[model samples]
Target: MKKNEVPQDGDNLVKGESNWLNYAVDQNGEYVQEISVGWEPENIALEQAWEVVNEKVEEARTKVLGGQLSPIAFYMEVNIMDIPLLANYMDKYQWQVRRHLQPDIFKQLSEETLDKYAYVFKISRTELMNVPTNKNTK
Candidate 1:
């Protein structure tokens, strides 16, 4: 589908500007430099994919608010990462990652460790500390 047909919805995966190669001839019928353009396609599959993501986010929010899991664990769930995956990303052992899921242990993490987790989650340490409240659950 053409770029004009791309959907603009809450579930849209491609919301902002994107690049696409254009191969159209110039007015003089000569090939010009390829220009960047915005392009995206509306697909039901992508919409459904976001639905699953939202469900997981909700679940994580619930767990965090209920005190069943720590804020870090909630972020892990929202980011769709398991303990093993996060451990591999952080270059720590799986047991270390699991221990960090405990509220007591997470609270004692050093600034460097917090920075590592924040970097992986693409959030700041402050944001990581502020777990989503129940009211903000979406």
Candidate 2:
């Protein structure tokens, strides 16, 4: 693609900022780095990916509310993390993190443990403890 051919079709992911890096051919017939506002295909792909993420998060939320899983599961889905990754962040073993995903085990967690999770998720302890009741709440 030529530098001048780079798409700037307007729908930016970050409000008004355009920070997508792309490579294109310059007038000199050499490769050049270009900054694009966005591309239609890339935007569509990202939208689809977010839709999947939202679906998973919703599924986890329902499970938590039904006592099938813990709020940790919901937040874990929201943060796009699996047990192993979450355990790495919490400095815990995968088995221990998996146990915390249980509703009963979550209920028995101490303030210190909850605080550590909240820190990883960048949310308040209260937010970490409570799963959003609806999509709007999230």
Candidate 3:
């Protein structure tokens, strides 16, 4: 796969407007909400989702703190099983991920100029949030 080519999986992996979905792990595994964002992007949905998740995590931290933002470490476990296509794209062509998302330009993601991509996963926040701090620590 080349850098410019899009993945093989068809579009429409996620439907409708750009929004955030929540799923609880311990419960019956139901979708909690679809928090809609005012802006939309055809292919940068994951970036948007990451920003939203980061925002919520910050809010949680703020509540935990005395209403002040603090730098806390966290992990995000995205099940790429569903979005295999996007995963492949990232693996094959995403230079940032290739270099472990290092360097200023990759961290900024300013080079992601393409459009019209899709995500096969559910794109939920709770799942992403629980990844780093889950009880499976070694």
What are the TM-scores, per candidate, against the unseen true structure?
0.63, 0.86, 0.22
Q: Rank the candidates by lDDT, best first.
A: 2, 1, 3
Candidate 1 runs further than 4 Å off: 1-42, 134-138
List per-prediction Cα lDDT, in the order shown: 0.73, 0.89, 0.33
Q: What shift in Å separates residue 62 of candidate 1 from its native position after superposition?
A: 1.4
lDDT per residue as tens, model 2, 1-138: 999999976564545475688899999999999989877787788778988888999999999999999999999998999998999999999999999999899999999999999999999999988888978465
Evaluate model 3: give its lDDT.
0.33
lDDT of 1 by residue, 1-138 (tens): 233333333333554444445565566666554534343334456567877877777777777767766678878876888899999999999999989888778889999999999999889899888786764443
The Cα RMSD of model 2 versus the native structure comes to 2.0
Better of 1 and 2 by lDDT: 2
| Model 3 alpha-carbon drift over 4 Å, by segment | 1-43, 67-138
Clashes in candidate 1: how many? 0
Clash statistics: count for each candidate: 0, 0, 0
The 10 consecutive residues of candidate 2 with the worst lDDT sum are 9-18
- Tens digits of per-residue lDDT for model 3, 51-123: 6665655444443234221111122123322223443654545433333222233223322321112122233
Better of 1 and 3 by TM-score: 1
TM-score, predicted candidate 3 vs. hidden true structure: 0.22
